[model samples]
Target: MMEPAVCGEPTEPAAPPPLLAQLRAWLAAWLTDERTARELVDYGRVGHYTLALTRWVAIIGQLFTVLFVHFSIGIALPLVPLLAAIAASALVNLVLLWVLGWRARLSERAAAGMFVFDLAQLALLLGLTGGIQNPFVVLLLVPVGIAAGLLGRTFTATVTALGLLVASLLAADPLPLPWFTGGLVFPELYRFAAWAALSTAILLIAVYTYQFAEEARHRAEALAATRLALAREQELAALGGQAAAAAHMLGSPLGTIAVVAKELVNALPADHPLREEANEILDQVHRCREILKTLGPRRAGSEVDRLVRAPLSATLRDIADEFGRAGISTEVRVDSPDGTPEPCLALPPDIRHAIANLVDNAIQFATSRVDILVSSSHERLLVAIRDDGPGFSPDILDWIGEPYLSTRHDRGGLGLGIFIANTLLARTGGKLHFGNTGRGAEVRIEWPAGALERAVEEREHDGGHD
Candidate 1:
């Protein structure tokens, strides 16, 4: 057996790798891509939000700053400048809130936009007070943190560099706010340098942490998808296995039915109704033969699965032809053959017989058309059959796939059509699922290219005319 996808098989195209190493490599690649980089730009929107909140914080902070200065014997006119900064900051905050809501649907772009908005808000707050000396200048950490949360490594580096540059510039040319001391000595300059270094480290660390969390989320989703596919593949193999075995065993009984029916046909007097019945018996036996014909090829695992690829149109036509002979009007919409080379190994004729019986059942209730739809998505092929007849009651869903569940007006059907389809999928690592769980009835089969090999001989052969 091949290694499962999660286990990383040699032939699996999208194999899962060791998650830690995969995360690191993916992050490196993400940061380098221009499109991913552009998504980082949306982080500025977070800045936009912080600015609004910052505006209110500064307003409240200014009120306290003024009260403190007024009550203190030495504290002075610093209140005037700080209050003005607070008011200007509030206006910017409101505008940014508008921008974020207005563009929430921008997704990644929104994240980048918020980042820039936060940065500008921080810069404005620093400028309003005595540059780096402003107490609330701790606000600068907000934008860098937002950037880290939403962007990959490269964008994060850009944010860190921009933050350091802004902080350094503010520390060097302390804004001429009223809060600044009339003169500064070495002690104040040294304190100012320390503040700048601390702010830069805070921003860089924030962004890096956020990037790690996002990468972890992506890995989790990818693992979940792989698990689902593997489960489905296992189901198909089981169905195919049961189908091949049943078809092989049924050969003897079906052959006996034919032999007995032929013997009766000759023994009956010319006008006897019993003779008609035996002829009918002969026809039913032939249907059983066709079923066996469709099930003859049964390959296991990847090497055998591809043996059953059929033209979507061809499969539909073959199905329609069988039902049409039974007085059913089936219409098929076949998408043009996909150009990919086919795998070999066609299904035995009995599998088609089982499918035909399903169409025949639908015809019993259908007023007009029976629709057969075939579609493929890469390595998977899907065939869906639907009838607009009165739908089956939910009570029948459980019984439908069982081998001998029959409720027919004609004593002919054994209700084993769906059973064989389900069985065939089990043998090939494919699946058959009932659809429209509510009112209408639909049966769908999903098979991998590898599993098809058991049912078909080659991938590129021209399918017979309908």
Candidate 2:
């Protein structure tokens, strides 16, 4: 016998749910979660005009079919009910157009509701005509398929389930098929087979359509992100160029100040107060010159020449230095196969930024060391960045450079770094390869000899003409 519960005492906690029940609950929660839906399904916008136009077409088709069957074929359809259903659909479409202007975009819920209405209307028509026995019963898959492409999984599943329910009900008991003689009757097994076929088709079509649409949407979003990242890298490079220009312009003034300060210090007595002030001025001028030196290439030449060209070794070394972290050691090595001098190529900002991004990614993943190797020959140039850490996951290795494909969720990145790097490199006629080299992951980028250089030169020439 159970004892009476006390006011403050807690009752025994309910027994844990059975495994099947728990699984069902989990699935329901996952399907209903709004955040998951938004992330998985990016149904951008459904315009009112588009929905209205499609509805108008469907209405016209339905009208034509009903009129032709009833009058031309002399088959007796429940004309009043059939016409009423079509008119109801038209009226609903009209109301939608009136409330939401033609150009207005629909919210996900509203779009889903419109699809539900379409499914209901189609179901009603099928039930009246002959349910699954009618050839037109196949139309039941249409709304569900469309919804799967444009709506979230929850809404799509709901529509599909609704369609299945309607089909089942109609198959069990529906109006006889119209005929010139009496109403045509179908076998129970035939009706059941038709229902099964339609249900299977709806599920299959919905799944396939959703998968294709989702993949296309993901690709589009990833491309947009890649473009944005490239634009940002270009901006930063432009800012660096501006800094070089500033450094160039200020060099003469700073030198003049240093010279004036030195003269003042030499003219005055060693212990004079003005001499100390002059010495301070000289020190500041020296400091300013040092700061400017770090801002741009140290080579003595026109600003454009200094900023536009760099040896492959120097570029790799600069990137390694920039990405060096306290725990990681970055090394850059350049090899010339024929014992020739290092190639001094036109260094476009896009290329520099792409190299830098790859180096940074390597550093982020490396346990202790990142190595950048650049090898050039008469035929091709190759750059490989390798990291001594856990290599690429086997599952995603084949998809390494694709956008938003990353195994580094621990690093809190959207996985666009590699994609952006790959895209920028490709734009400059480079091909990238990904692999693991026993110790860690390696990304190899290759370009035909002189390809990048010629590309850059042509771009500069075009810019000059522009």
Candidate 3:
């Protein structure tokens, strides 16, 4: 039928399907958001065994609940459809197990797909049994929670949206609740309340679980980085020891060769052809000795002390000089109790590396000058590094030695230097204090006076026994 247009009357446009509109928006957002794309691409995988075990538990529980309610309690449930849904889930699980094996790890997309399936299956079962009116409707939140903990943010959000959508649909026109007397009826307001409660719980639980799991993952990664740094320092120290041993072993033979060459040069006539060759041999032998000496002390008596130990003042001065040459005016000062010689410490590679890292950090932030102060007494040794520049940010000062805690984003550093230095210092019984001085940032490292020497001695003793 056709009607003539009226001048004062207007007709409304037809609205798009809600589901199609939502799907379009979701797709557009996923395609446009770079962070979400990266997360989905790089998210870690979940093991097959873990997924299978959880699914089996859920399936068994569902079967048991349906059987008990329909048979034992005599509730007139749609047993065939309920069992069919459960069997569908079980069949999918079996197919996955058979194809992928129990040891397989599901990729990010694969895991997300599996979770979506589980959510849909659970929603379907709820739709048949009475939707939000059924007590088992609470189980719908489980998959979303697990996804939030194991999957990326976008995936979690997607799962949550699906759960909300299903809950809303169930609220609209769910099948009657199974009961001994025909069917149990719930008020419309009560059903709405249940839907609202379930939706709120899903969001809250997902957020909490995601945050907790993310924190644990970050801590684990930081610890792994720390261990790698420490291991590298240990490897360098081991290499140094090997070089010292080689130098010690080679010194005697080189000395013997030098003596023989010198004697031959003296015994041969200057005009003899052998005389120049002998002199060349002696010169080469001298060069070899000099090279070995640079590696370590040639004499066994002083090898350990000369190669492994250095005065604390000298170490600080060396670190200061290194940074001083890099455009920063670095100064070092040493103080001790009256008439006491400066303490010499076993300069293990880790300790040296830690000290160097601190000095380098100071230089990086210093506007023009850096000051290094060393003080020693009978009981303790202390080192303080200060710089004239903008001090540490007050917000992060309390969390100073934690991994990846950095304020200098412009430098493209991961902020592991301080954490590595702090960790190594702690291992050697040193305590670090961080604060802001009047002009800039200040870091103080303190250790027992003899701790360095004792640690070295223990290591050497252990090595000998091994």
Candidate 4:
């Protein structure tokens, strides 16, 4: 498999470079690549709106040229004035496109300010010619859509007010589209009123639609976070139960080695190299005994995974949101057996604790971003947390969630989080898995529900007999 790029290991040292080397390096990296193109998909709306605005500008320019000639034949103002105005309109449109480009690439705050510039330019254009009568005044939709899509509720409302104020001021000031089509196209009292009513309706709908879409997006995100939390709990439980069993299964074999080593020690000659090696073997047995002693008092061979249960959406969302508020860009998406959020029953806090630990683990290493995805089959709820950070070492990946295996030497090898995480999950009846995910490592919590239910049932059966 390809090595992960962002493993959480301490960064490798970079070679020194000459001055202006930084600038050149920056420029070279900025040269667009596949990733650049992929990122640009987010700017598709800006590209689309640019084209729409460009088309309007062209159409309005042609209309202006024709109107200017007709006005020159009879009006008091010089043909120069109208032509100059037309030139100015075209120049402003060019600037609008430029600003639009900037808005697409910039942050939300910057985009809001740029949108103000776009609005003012269009409002100015409406004032120069005819406000409501300027057929192209309907071009207001572009900026309105921009506001609705990019601006927050307050900023959007502000933009709407400015647009309406500008439109009303221009509408009352009758500027005509220079009619070169031989007949003057002018709106009467009722006609202009109707146009304003219809356009206003359209603009309001766009704003409302934007708000609806944003709300839906937030709800979906919340749902997803909930699912991931649930999965993390389930997966952790499963991991723990399996590890405990594996630890238990080793006991018999380890005991046999201890017994055989005792026999060999008795058979070896005194002070011999062979006897010294047998003594070493006996020490190894003692170490093995020490290791297994950590398993505490287990009912030997009983199901440890029996207590784990899959978590619900509400549980997962809280985990993601809690991390997100701490400046980690956390996102959660939840998929149940039906691939939707249905009412889930209450689950234990152990599952919640196991998942929060996973999120906290990622928050520690993530540069700025974290994602949690939750899905479950009939058997297990799979919770995966992926981060934009350095990932695990190969050895760590192989044994992560296993008791005593750790990657944290930086903080003095405090790895009990994984041990506890694994133990908690196993106790609850799930599994905790850790590995590198491309630029970061992913931790998966898998809960096998049937095994847990079976274990619970077996306990109940034994209780009844007792």
Prediction 4 global C-alpha lDDT = 0.61
lDDT, model 4, position 331:
77
Best-fitting candidate, scored by TM-score: 3
lDDT by residue for model 3 (75-108), tens:
8788888899999999989877656667765565
Q: Give me the runs in candidate 1 sitting further than 4 Å from their true place.
A: 1-74, 77-85, 96-103, 134-136, 175-192, 199-203, 231-466
Q: Candidate 2 clashing pairs?
A: none
Q: How does model 2 fare in lDDT?
A: 0.80
Stretch of 10 with least lDDT, candidate 1: 457-466
Per-candidate clashes come to: 79, 0, 0, 37
TM-score of each model, paired residue for residue: 0.41, 0.66, 0.70, 0.44
Q: lDDT by residue for model 4 over 80-115, one digit each (tens)?
A: 554554566567445545434333343344445545
Clashing residue pairs in candidate 3 are: none
Candidate with the larger TM-score of 2 and 4: 2
The segments of candidate 4 whose C-alpha lies over 4 angstroms from its true place after superposition are 1-104, 180-188, 195-199, 223-260, 265-350, 353-466
- What lDDT score goes with residue 408 in model 2? 82
Computed on alpha carbons, the lDDT of every model, listed in order, comes to 0.59, 0.80, 0.80, 0.61
lDDT of 2 by residue, 1-466 (tens): 9998999999998799998767655643443345443522357555667778989999999999999988998888898999999999999887665555577556566677788899889888888888788999888777888888887777878888888888888888877888788688899889888888888888899889888876777689888988787778678757767887898899999989999999999899988978988999999999898778667643324354556578887878877887788989888888888865556766767777788888888898899999888888888888899999898888888888876678888778766777888888888899988889999989898989877777766655543331
